[model samples]
Target: MIFSSLLFIFRFLPIALAIYYLAPAKLKNLALFLVSIFFYSWGEVRYFPIMLACIVGNYFIAIFLGKNQDKPTVRRWLLVLTLVFNLGMLFFFKYTDFFIININALFGTSIGLLRLTLPLGISFYTFQTMSYTLDVYRGEVEPERNIIDLGAYVVMFPQLIAGPIVLYKDVAAQLKVHKNRYTLSEIDAGIGLFVLGLAKKVLLANSIGALWDDIKVLGYANISTPLAWLGAIAFTLQIYFDFSGYSTMAIGLGKMLGFNFPLNFNLPYISRSITDFWRRWHMTLSGWFREYLYIPLGGNRRGMKRQVLNLFIVWCLTGFWHGANWNFLLWGFYYFVLLTVEKLWLHKPLAKGKIWPHIYALFFIVVGWAIFAVDTGMGDLAMFFSKLFIPQSGISAGYFVRNYGLSLLLGIVCSTPYPGRFYHKLCRQKKEVLRIAFLAVLLLVSIAYLVDSTYNPFIYFRF
Candidate 1:
């Protein structure tokens, strides 16, 4: 179940937390594993077994490889097999239907597609679990001996659903050595982070989500130039808040449990270049791709041309990883093209300017999300590109304000960390009046919105 859903927020989380704390320190891992299975089963009871099987399979594989690390051929083969099996499971479940449809379209065959159901966070957990096995085989981490600890590592409920893609090594120590009880300092930090994240989702992300949905629905049929640009910008903002909001909540939840999840976002929009953008946006995933895939395939350390090829492969896979859609490929390569241009031709002089760097980064990424969002065809993307430059109609500014002006403003504010930082600073003052007043207002508003919300799905759970 999605974290935003009533069942999860009210029922599952509360029960799970209660059980988790009641368990003995030695049995905490067992408690967590059981709760995680319950959490996964809450959505799709059938597929939760599959997830469990995969988890168990990987643990054994890693244990086998770790035991036989001295034999080079055996280690290599084991790692390869682990990755193949992991990705095979992910691909068959997540992309087989799309792949089958493509085969039929290409070869004029009428073979029926598998029509497989996508499991929540299949790609995410698969990658995370695979990382654990591969890293253990590589001697980056010792294979987890207790299957229960491994289970907790793979199925930690906070980052399990919508991830910052916590690496095995990053969270391994916590799994083995984590305390059962949280300190007062941990509790304070956790509460602050949780409240801030809740505000981001309930207040900011939802506002932008409505505007984004409205724009896409309208812009699909009658595409005006200005309106198309507005839609593109709206979507960019919507996805940023939606995905980042989930990550924030996950990180906050981790903190509450006395675990620290590394930051995922770092004001990516403020990046000066495409390379800088990758460094900031979804930092964990990029780091994973860099360490696991790119480096294995010969990173920039090898040579220039191979580096380019490596970059291309990563981007294409990154795109395909987003969905089975062609537009995502276009979205990925869109940045690759700009990155190439920046490196080859524009490196020396263009980046020297003040506004131009920010402008350059913003301009390219704005168009990039056009590919990411409008999934049907290139014509819509082209229309958006045209609208960004030329004004065909004045439908944008008026329509945006009329429909969701305040939300748009709130979204813009919440996408940045400024409001949260300011609030924290305000709360540190001696008088408890400000903190009291702020939470009271926030609680009333959040409750009001939650009561009215029908589109309360946490988007990243489907990742």
Candidate 2:
């Protein structure tokens, strides 16, 4: 039930919104909770029990932590137990096969893969639940007594599948006051933003993604250096638009529902440094690690060496968090090296440079995406890198560029802040009619694209 699908857009959303709006103020949380469970169950009904267990388990665990705040030893043990429970579920479903394969390879044992179906949004909800428990233990937030409210927060369909990764504290107040938070202006803004995001996903990302898809089918060995680089750039754009589009849609939906989800992407492509890129890209995830993992591991407070170790741990886990692939590990290590170098030395020089820094950051970022995208194992990954770095002639990028040049241009331009700035300028000039017309056209065009195309894919759903 992707947001871009006609079924979801036309059926589920309208009906759900109608039900939600018609519900009494006191029953709003219950309405939201039930509707959200239905949404999750629509795609993965088999996993509803797992999600229910998580909601129930974490809710009680948090309550226990909140109650045992005065006892440090008991609270610490409960927090550890909570971590084990959340991480255990994630590990079993997401990484069990990876570990099995690795162990089989290392020990020459034919361990059959469990091949468990990962519950959708398990990664995201796990973090959200953990954050709630951790905050409760820290005395930062009172435990949510209302299980229905907590369940609604956990299974909120908008950001549930692939998130900006909303934390409990961020929406705790909004959940309480949702009755009063509804406004026509906010709904209008949400519609506009959702349409814009829909255009980005259906039009720009999917069209540009076709180029990379073609290159992949052509095989790494058959592609010219230019073609390889072009594919890398295309993938870079596709992933950004795909994930950012989903996040934008999720945020917009949050707005419509009277919740203010945090910003996820912030023109990350324009970042001149790896550090800057991380700050902009999947910002909530970065913040999650920074707050829960990095700071706890002493952060920069101890010394450079300790901080480096902390970063290594965070990046390794961050990489693994994306998937069980070795390429993801390399991708994380790749950024770890880049960020460590920048933190230790390159930051000053990057800031000092002008155009070259942007080029340098972009160059590495594109290469990093290649690593992230190629999951066919190390041989293909190495071959792809060879095609990218070593000049070889086979198929030129000319044909692909001719086919996708407009989409590429649009993607590049939209990746920056200029388009958003221009739109805002029009709004500031009181061009309400123009704004409304533009949004209407965008929505109609996006719906047309959705109706016509079968290539709609949400990249982050795998995570």
TM-scores for the candidates: 0.94, 0.99
How many residue-pair clashes does candidate 1 contain?
Answer: 0
Give the Å shift of residue 362 in candidate 1.
1.3
Candidate 2, residue 459: the lDDT equals: 89
**Best of the candidates, lDDT:** 2
In candidate 1, stretches whose alpha carbon ends up further than 4 angstroms from where it belongs are: 178-181, 348-351, 377-397, 427-433
The alpha-carbon deviation from the true structure for residue 382 of candidate 1, after best TM-score superposition, in angstroms, is 4.9
Error of 2 at 29 (Å): 1.1
- In terms of TM-score, the best-performing candidate is 2
Tens-digit lDDT track for model 1 on 272-353? 8887888999888899899999999988888778888888899889888888777888877877777777777787766676
List per-candidate RMSD values in Å: 2.2, 1.0
Pairs of colliding residues, candidate 2? none
Question: How many clashes in each structure?
Answer: 0, 0
Worst 10-residue lDDT window, candidate 2: 178-187
